[model samples]
Target: MKKVSFLLSASALSAIAVPALAQDVVFKPVVEARLRYETVDQAGPAPLTSSRDANAVTMRLRAGGEISKGPFAFLAEGEGTLAIDEDYNSGVNGKTLYPIVADPENVELNRLQLQYRTKPLIVTVGRQRINLDDQRFVGSVAWRQNEQTFDAVRVEYMGVKNLKVDVTYAISARTIWGIDGGKFGSANRPTQIDGDDVFANVSYKTKLGTLTGFAYLVDEDEAVVALRRNSSQTYGARFVGALPFTKKVKLSYLASYARQSDYATNPVHYSADYVAAELGLDVAAFKLTGGYELLGSDAGATGIAGGFAFQTPFATLHKFNGWADKFLATPGTGIQDYYAGIGYTVPKIGKAGPLVASFTFHHFSSDRLSIHYGDEYNAQVTMKLNKHLSALIKYADYERKGIASFTGDADTKKFWAQIDYAL
Candidate 1:
């Protein structure tokens, strides 16, 4: 309560100061809302619940504004979420009888930060959002009802043309769960995680592509017992670019590699590697893509028995692996994924707007144990109703395969419908 009061007071003072300074200032207000319905069904033999189906209807709202003057700005935002159908385990809701649906009901401050921006340099401080290239290592986790944020300081230097440097030092990570999710250091999913985390990135652009080098050192402060095992250091590089074959055709590609090892006070002493490559071809309004990703394992290492695969606990897990979310946590034997997809953008229809439809398939396997986990099929369609409104329909099906004892996930299916509005 006191912190919220302080943020309000600060904003009021800033609004008054801007007029007194007699400078050119701009204030932009923001409002957004989303309503969604999701359902899930899985075959027998799941761990958390005896029930095989779940239904969840959720709504979220965000309200805030930005106050800015030349090279200086202050932003404050608040977010809230409501659940109409709670027939599912929200991780923090204690509804263990139904399948897991992560979005919970709660409210809290979202973002409050101050920034200084100029031609070749930008600095930001306070609770903010930091999403690096592709968001593979560090991201905002925006797909969830409550997005993740960081209480930290960030700096960017771009004095050299086609070259950029970015760095950040964060003290705490505000998780996707809301106020009802419990405090930091909780055994379950905590609302906050205290840590000494750092991220650094340097990128240069060329005719062929853009090349980037980065290092992420995450330290889940020992006080957070549930997350201590996630502490690690990762160093990686990435290349992404596109080539124009003609006026109507283009080729796009991305390749990334990262190495990870235990860091800070983490009890685990092991190392793993990550590799990913994706290619896409676009001709006119149609697109096709294929990719492979490997979350390497440390099995049979010096002192480790089962082994741990490369983990990206803070990443937007939903965007990778598969939409079925079966691989949110990498298996002990590690995992490999080969996927392909096709998409099309339809021309505007009447006053409705453009429509986009896509379908993807994924084949999953173990990196070391030679186990075929399963295969997943995903389909999605999105339509823009107007400028401020849109709708989405999506579905996913994952069929369990291989030895049932070795693979834990059951045959699962999920469906979703959503409506969004922004202003």
Candidate 2:
């Protein structure tokens, strides 16, 4: 019977090729790398250094991948770095070293992106990382080992379930390490052309928490409005809950007011006002935070000045406050900031992992409408020897009182130890 009709058509083509190879469409790839070491010590006045020392080493790499079929999906990533030994115009007795580690085997290109999701819509476009709200002034600086990436196009919406919405627009920005790394210079480079930033947020959630409202706009191009006219327009509101006398201890509050006119093209057309507040505590693994900020002055504005403010895209932004960064440009007698911090997470020494710590203190003054004021201290420690290795250490110190000659009472110290691995 013709060999049983060719074995029943080869068993119906092997059951339709085993469900089309189980509905094939799978892709996965990823990579990561890191190495770091640092040291610095400096001291005040004559002979340029109550003391001095420096040593550095750094390396990084990353790779990406992802793809799916059912609801459709895709993703991408990239990274690079190198900064071994370090020697960019070395100085010991002449004092000419402030992160000018020129040729530590330089390499760039931090991130590349592409994403899509459906179910309330989610979209992302090339060169990513942007953080709004509570970032305190824009973000994505990523603590530098080469970060800060944006070439944007982002959109997000959550149908309804406590209401959520997000929007982002940016054409270019790729600044990470090198603008004179560390203390950033080249006039604080970060204004890649075709600039645009617009953020709109609306949120509502209850059970005694979550409320947000925001509007922020940034438009620049003319060399970033001739070096930070900061292209103004801002409005804000934020509130977080769970402290009706303690629901495990949690509280948050923020208020913002901005009115900067003359379009700020930098020929000194002044108008300014800003205010801030924050408080938080968690109590289980222990955490505490505090904040107070104010900037207001414009009576004969010659070029509007302010204080303790200049996040300018963040990522471990020097833990915020003055050392010799010369107040990061903002002084028209406008500035004041008081800060506090504490954090701890231990609970896991038996498995050889778990230990974290933090400490911060800052007090800067100046708003007799903006010159400069100073006091700062910061510390951090981290340890986790499992799930891909980890270790870190950090420190910073600064002090200067009474407009201390452009604020450089010149007492600084920095040190870091690092180890990280993941795949």
Candidate 3:
């Protein structure tokens, strides 16, 4: 309660400060609402079978204004959540015996920042979102009901055309999902880490294609420090452009390699490497994509390991191969995944928005060639009701091909319907 009070007070005071300079300040209020229904058929291992069928509602209200007179600007946003249907936990094998105190009604601040923008340079400090090139490993985790936001200081320079640079330093992480929520971990010992990460990227365009190079550095704290020892770094490049074959067809590709050393948060001192590549083609109303990834692992290594696969903490994360979430932590043996998919947009109906649909198939294997593999199928559909409203539904299934791990081979199914409105 005290923390929330402090934040609200701070926001009010910050807003008042802008008018002192006699600059005409403009305040814009922002608001958004979302309602979701989800059903989980199975979760976790036996003796603790878990599943949930519940309805969740989230709301966000924000008031921010600009100090039009100067190069300074400020913004603040807050959000809260609510859950309906108290008996929903029964779907998880009678695990809802206790009173539900953690149901989404908790209110929290999402973003509060002050910025200074000038020709060629821009600086921002406060709670915000940090997303860089594809958001593979480092991202804001925005798929959940509440989006994960970072508290940091960032700067950018764009003095030259076709060339841009950015840097960010974080002091804390205000995760959208509750610390004790299953989305993160057990309530008994919720994990929270404080640290800093830096990222830089440079891009150039030519007649044939555009090339981009990026690097990242992440330093961990004590609690999360074990996840990445002193620090971790990544370097990679990407090229995307249209094909010379024809004017109606387009092609794109991405390739990256990362090396991990003792800087990893684990106690074990080991090094790993990752390689990933993807190819995509666009023609008419349909799009096709395929990709391959290989994560390196030493057979003798112990502890949670790293992989080269593209890690998206958001974007319907469960759609990826392997178990929906069983491999979120990644195994030391490493992994290899081959995937392909197609996407198309259906023609719009009279007075209705267009329908978007996609299907993807993925095959997963161990980089060490030890265990058998598995595969998954994912499909989803989405439609927009209007400029500010949209709806979505998705499904995913994973099947074991050979050997299986504790993650389970038993088929799992999930269904979700959601409506979002923004202003």
How does each model score on lDDT? 0.84, 0.57, 0.59
Predicted model with the maximum lDDT: 1
Ten-residue stretch with the least lDDT total in model 2:
87-96
Candidate 2 local lDDT, 28-113, one digit each (tens): 67676778776656565655454336666777676775554544444456676676666322221122554322223334444444
What lDDT score goes with residue 113 in model 1?
Answer: 80
Instruction: Give lDDT for model 1.
Output: 0.84
Off by over 4 Å in 1: 1-20, 46-49, 182-186, 222-224, 301-304, 404-408
User: Clash number for model 1?
Assistant: 0
After superposition, candidate 3 runs with Cα above 4 Å error = 1-16, 43-70, 86-105, 179-192, 224-231, 244-247, 264-266, 302-323, 406-410
lDDT of 1 by residue, 55-116 (tens): 99999999999888887788888999999988877778877667778898879888888777
Among all windows of ten consecutive residues in candidate 1, which has the lowest summed lDDT? 1-10
Give TM per candidate.
0.93, 0.31, 0.81
> Would you give me the overall lDDT of model 3?
0.59
**lDDT (Cα) of model 2:** 0.57
Q: What ordering of candidates by TM-score runs from best to worst? A: 1, 3, 2
